[model samples]
Target: MNDEVTRYIDGAAPWQTAVCEKLRLMVHETVPEVEEQLQYGKPHFLQNGDHAAVIAVARNKVSFMVFNATEIPVVKGFVRALGKGDRKCVDIAEGQEVDYAALADILRKTTIAP
Candidate 1:
């Protein structure tokens, strides 16, 4: 984890922090060689130096974004947000329960090691 990313996560709300941490762990588990840094005010995860995902924390929710997403995963208990191009993000509300298993599956299929 980059210092900037740590600071970003540490400064987030408790719920957001927890979700971000979970996302971070899942990202690493899915792609062991993934590199992390703060980009565009979010925690960016790179696989083989390619943009893979980003974790964003907002006032009301925390979002996990998958870049170059071809088919967005249908995750239970999440609000899907689509951005420009192939980027897709799933937002978890403040008191929402995340489906870590499903998220891990999605990341497993999405993240590329090289």
Candidate 2:
């Protein structure tokens, strides 16, 4: 993890920090080849030198943005962000239990090299 990214996450609220860490750990644990870095002032995960995912902390929730995630996964306890694009996000609010296993599966599929 980059120092800047670490600081960015550490500066968030406690609930956001916890959710951010969960997604960060999921990326590293499930896709060891992915690189961690700061992009557009947020922590981004890269795979094959392409943007794979991003961690965005908001006032009410932390967003796990999955790039090229055209197909939504059936992850429990995760709500898809409302938007349009080849991207989608799972908004995790305070006290929400993160389903790491399901998130790992989604990460694997979304980050796979075509």
Model 1, range 26-98, lDDT digits (tens) per residue?
Answer: 8888878899999888899998788988898888988888876666654455636475436667888987878
Whole-model lDDT, model 1: 0.80
Best by lDDT, which number?
A: 2
Model 2 Cα lDDT, one tens digit per residue, 78-98: 646445646767888888877
Candidate 1: residue pairs that collide: none
TM-scores of all candidate predictions against the true structure: 0.86, 0.86
**Alpha-carbon runs more than 4 Å astray in model 2:** 73-84
Q: Count of backbone clashes for each model?
A: 0, 0
| lDDT value, residue 15 of candidate 2 | 79
